[model samples]
Target: MYFSQNAIILVMLMFVVSAVFYSTINYQTKAVEDEIKIKEVSIYEKNVKNTIDRNINKIVEDAFVNASYKIMKSRKFFPNAKVAVNYITSFIKNETNKSLKCIVGNSSNITFDVGSFDIEPTDDPLKIRVIGNIELRYTERLNNGEIVGLKNIQIDKEVKLSRIPDPYVYLNKFYYKWEYGRKIILNNFPNDDKNHTFCIILNDSNFNYNRMYNENSPTEIRIIGRNSSTGRWNVVLPYWVQTWREGNNHVSIIWVKVNNKELLNVSEDYIYLLYNSTTPVDREDPENTFILFDNFDYFDPDKWNESGEILINNSKLTVVAGAGSSVFSKDTYGEGYELMFRANFSYTPENNSESAGLFNKLDDTGGYGWAYYGDGDFEIVMGDDSYGIDNTFDYINKTYIYDLILNNISNHPYIEYNIYDSTLNLEYSKRETGSFDGTYPISINALPPENKTSNTNITVDWIFLKDVNNITATVGAENIQPITYTEEKPKTFNGVIYYGVGAYDKVYNGTYSIIGLFTNKSDYWKYPTTVGYKPLIEEN
Candidate 1:
């Protein structure tokens, strides 16, 4: 195989060129394979990132829906902005944690940790913005290798809540604008004039009269009228009782007078009977206190006892005579009292025994009293002794005032009767010397001429009795308690006070008891607009 020097060199050069060519081809092929590996790794990373981004958004949406449901079902008032925001933030955090388990893309190696949320109020009073930071640790195993990393994702969202109602409106659309502590709202009164004087009935059990009637609060209780003209609350006067009972809910009639220039619209405007004092109020109408005084405005079972066809009609106590009707007071009055009443007859009676007038008794079966008979005779019975006076005036089909005074003079009780026509002109007067004993329960009766067959009846308009022991001066109330001008902090729920919206104000019904009237139907708090939820990405 030996050859010349030139040939040998040529052969060596050829071998070297072949080796270099093969090495270059191998290097180029390795570079191309590395590029393909890099592209695959990049694509896998991008896909994983996209999956996490999509899952994060879905989690936020689900959490928002869950929070909104919880909020709607929670029938509670948000006392202030801080309370509301905290409540909402807590709800969102809880819901997000639950929804974290639903993230897709990785079956087992997926880990999503939802962190604390920051809730902020937007310019729109109805909308609230929520920002959440989530830590995602995802491990993706591929044929090539395993891709492991942690991602911090920030989600920004806005939610709307408008289903809640304002609490202040439930407090009569005015939350202690005039006074605080205890308040009784009165509406549904007749509002035909600018000045209104009317009576309101309240449950005694609901009011703290001890706190209301204190000297420090003498004027502490005020009748604040909602002035429609000024859209403000004005203190009119202190309200007092025309008739009040000490026992629980025993015909407590408080009379209020609002003398504002603007006509009080009872249907639209409410009168706030505010009380926030701890001082005792002096008795201004002590003399006006009566043993019994009823105008028959409403039938109060606590005040009267009736037998047969006795009922109240048009504010009058009507006693039909078909079955021997009678109405008596549940309360009794003592001697030294003036008993006066106004009465009228349905038809004339035909017998002297059939009569209608006032009666007082120490017992149920027998008593001493007086009456005007259908036979045109006025009779008076003392003990068992009875006397009759021939009818000197028309006493049928018309109204008359019968005033009877029973007092002790020189330690001897006497009975004096004065009868007047409807016009208040005296028609008959009488005085009888006698000795009466014991307290008496007053009554009005109608004895049918035929017992159970007569159609004639009697109607008593009103009955009034002075002090149990004696007659006193007339009662006139111009002012009740003095008004206390003091500023006090309003009551709050959970240390936060809530303002009111006019739309949630309830219609005031004077007929309801104080407990029923002040029912807070608007306990559920709400936003001003409709609910909305949208998630938008934000930096940081």
Candidate 2:
């Protein structure tokens, strides 16, 4: 019985050992299978994640393109259209979801968030731009704190919009005026604003010309003035006018008269003059008949106001002055005059103490003068102080002809000082515009300081004063030209008028408004639109 029991125990122990080994092998096989299954699951998740990422990226790119097209189309229709971020995001989602739903098969897998978007007009008035940032999130659900697939797709986009040319009209007008002998007049002769009847009254009766007047058929009238003297019926036009002829013997007066004054009440509108002259007028002649010419042959006290030591030798007038000595003309010349002289300094000081040049409009206390200083500089002086500097030429013991023109005839008065070389070629010229405060007594002075170290001397070769006759025409100002008038031919005034029509967004009111207005025209018309005039507005 003990042997049988021991055999049973040994078999039982062997069976237990076999059962434990089989359990260990089964557990090891199961561990390896679990590892392979986990690896397979990981690979599958990676593929799904890659696909999701690609789909998400594609969706973002498509969304950006579609959004850009939408914004560009919208801006073409409405140039100043304001698109919100929510609207853009909604548009992108609607467009992308259509394709994304087919790819991903789940609406929850594809999602979008637009961070920012804006549409604004650029500096180019015809163009606008759209700029924004967007993010697309693609995700697939997995168990227990693990994400099988996830992708955050980002996109940045910019879009520029353009459009066709807008419609506009160009508008302008032509103005015409008649200038006659320092006077300007509008074309309405019978009903002029000044209400003066212009006529060419006979003065000497020496020359023969025709004077025809017909009250009923009065489109134009021609009258002749004799002897070139002041006639009885002399009228001055409102603006400055100039008319020139080669010889001042014969004068022709032409006038324009409307047949019906009531119908053509607008004088400043469309009246043009046709000038047909057989002889071209010489307008550059000096006006005054008398000219002051002196060669410094003799010292004439009747012509000059002399102070200090003045010497006249070898046909040259020399003035030696200490601190406060000057010599000027006794008679005063009017405006529109030029004073010219050739001068040389005996000695120019190294220090800035001496000055010598032409002084005009002089008095005891102060005067306006153009001077050359000791130190290579030219200056325009008002009394003791300098007003402007013209450093064109440095006067150092040289002879130069100086011409100073004072023009007070125009509405804008100006003074021009010119220096010429020894050959009378113009070297330097400076002009200034201002109100001159002195009368026209011309002088030549050698000025020195209070504590003068040396006496200043100036030698003048000759002095000449002449009157300037012609008026200089400035740009954009009234220019006068002489023209003959005939009954058969009349001048035509033609011009183009521009108008602009624009559609602008009333952003505050959320509506659009159309603006139509006239743009450019000549200075004749007072108002753009008349009492019953209406502009034709065509929409295209």
Candidate 3:
């Protein structure tokens, strides 16, 4: 009986232990299943958010493309500003609807808010801005019945509208007086109230050595003075009327009439007349400024002083120089001036010992200039000193455009030089700051190596010089189209357009996105007049 009872207790304990073990296993299994369900839901939500963000971005991009296309198209076809703006706005609205419909699929709840469009006008191009938002509603809903969606994705963008024959205006303060008379007077001067000066540029095709200096030749040109009153003309020869003669047939003269002289500004009412004895007047400027442009179409002997052995043919100036030879300009330059020319050499030297190039500030003593060596090197020289040596260039038989600028307005005057190789599309530039005394003139020099070729030939296409400060007008269009009726006309027009978008939930809770206001600029010129018009001519 006692053994039987012990066996029974052992069996009962085993049963209770089995029950506890089964219950613990079931609880662990349930907990694991619940955790897996939560993870699946979280991943699903993340995927939905990513899909919505991508779709929103695509919609914004499509809208921007559509608007830009319409705007550019309108500008091309329409000449009037208001008409173009209206057409573009309407087209964009229509296109935006179509683009959004295609992007969002067949969803009735998807909507777009196009914000205000902004447009501003300038002289050449129009600036435009666009802002807006997109709202997407999905059929799937959250536990609280909120629609799965993206709301108020904003877009802010800008673009420019360009036009052909852009609007511009030019002012004319320089002119040539060509009417013949014993007393030459420039009437109806522009900007008369401002302090003015006059420069008379004389060019005689038939001028000779005897006619330039002698008082007997009928072709001899002379400037006596100004008529203070109607009955009285004064014979005051200003000290600045200097003449420089090249060869025998051409004579170039420069005369300056300043405002401080009593003979010139006797009274603002009376016109200042120049008395010419014989030679026909070539050109005259009310402002004492001149542009020196030469293409060597025919050798204008009055323009340049040739040195060494120089040849002018086929619209080129070729200088053949030995060890020490140079060609200098007969005319002098001062203050704000820009000099541009093109040059090339026939051959390259084997060593850096030989040099040839352009020089300025040249006098009887020495000068500052730039030199190109036969060994593919370039140098800048001031007086007897040299700086900025670059030997890595390959300038053999290559044409290079040289642009030099002298700025003398500040206490420290500086020179800027730019060399452009149009053939190879390479550029090298240098700037030097120093004190420069505005005297002497410009020249071209070449030095050949000893025991080498006796002469090194340098060819120049053309040279141009102009006053930097006297840019009275600009030819802003091709074929010399008229841009403005008068100098006072407006050159640019500006305007703005606005765009906005809003999104709302079922309970009226909503968010708004705005493509904020932007501006566009349109530039235009007025109809041109003949009074101050000058054609920009290129010499071949």
Candidate 4:
């Protein structure tokens, strides 16, 4: 009985030990499997996280590049920070949706969200910083189970604006905020003259200068000469413009004093002009504002228009009229001009009904003039009749000087005529006519008592409109050729003209001077690109 009981106890003990061993093996196997599963999930999560990070970087980088190009293409430089940041952020989201597939180890179940963007200023003047948030969600299926991964990464990038243009860099190259520019070449310039006052006439025949100035506002025109020694473009100031009319064949007469030592050594240089809302430089009282000066050495079609028989001899313009004839100035005068005529009578009027003399205002409707009648009398005449007669004066063949001045004092405009004998140097007559508010051409006319009967003639020695300042200065004509000489027909000149618009913006609004290497025919102009900017070539 004791042996049997001991055997039973041993069996039971062995059974209990086997059960414990099996339990231990099962527990070990499960622990090892769980560890392997954990490692697999960790590896998959790491791969997805790395992929999301790489894609986020790529998307951000590409957005910056694309935004830069967009800004350049649009020519909207110096945009506000908000605008720039929005551009980058919007591009990134749109591009990611279109392309940018984030996959890790053939796992296609991955998605990302790009959150808001923040922009900050950098130490460099031309650089900016951008920060973005990316939320990535990844799901993958493994042999043991499924793995779900979530990551939130913040991306901070510094964008260098090296590709954009620096406005200050380009503005420093020019003397003014000139809107237009062109190249001019100097040839046959007098080398002997050290200081020359060049008279540059901007006319329709030479260039379309009417388009150069701002009609609605005051215009400041300038000539820029490049310095040979300093290798910099220098501004030429104290320049004068006698006439600047914006009409057909009208002129803008500019006189510039250039120092030979300071002028550009190269054959070509640039001329710049500006339009600003501010008042232009006062050139009215300057010595260089000569309205007109002509010696009549030769017949210049550009200066005079003659009708009937006319002859040029001994520096004289002689007009003979059997019935009626006239010589008139091509340019008409408005309110602020003075006409000086020097002439002698070639043939006095034959009778009381005949007349010959100078006219200050001439048009289709009878003009105001000083006439010598056939009765040895001088008269201030209107059209064919005498208004004010000077019968005491004797009419003879002698040189005489006449002046017609338009006075614009106190807003009341009137015409005054003064007659003097050149030989005696004494004033003969002075008269003030009624106020006339119109433009008229200067003319010399001769009228006979009857058609094709009386011999009426006059010879003009010289005629010129007096300079406004009334001071005489030596004028330089070294490189100025008024019109092409008869010998040099069809010879084109070597200068270009451009008028710019930014002067107004600079003067009135404090805008930066634009970089202009462009030629535009339209009044509107686009800004050009520079250092951190890009420019599209503006076609002429």
What TM-score goes with each of the models?
0.46, 0.32, 0.33, 0.33
- List the candidate 2 regions with Cα displacement exceeding 4 Å: 1-291, 350-366, 382-393, 451-453, 471-540
Q: Candidate 2: lDDT over CA atoms?
A: 0.43
lDDT of 3 at 209: 32
Ranking by lDDT: 1, 4, 3, 2
The TM-score measured for candidate 3 stands at 0.33
Among all candidates shown, the one with the greatest lDDT: 1
* Candidate that beats the other on lDDT, 1 or 3, i.e. the better one: 1
**In model 1, how large is the Cα lDDT of residue 189?**
36
The TM-score that candidate 1 achieves is 0.46
Instruction: Compose the digit string of candidate 1's lDDT tens values, residues 269-381.
Output: 44455554432333233123344667788876787777767778898987766657667778765566777678775445455233332355212123456655555655665
Which whole-number lDDT from 0 to 100 does residue 263 have in model 2?
Answer: 20
Residue 170 shift from truth in candidate 3, angstroms: 35
> Distance from true position, residue 75, model 2, in Å?
99
Model 3, span 410-526: residue lDDT tens: 455777767765321238777777655555466766555654444666787866665433212111111111111111222222421212111111111111111110112231221
How does model 4 score by TM-score?
Answer: 0.33
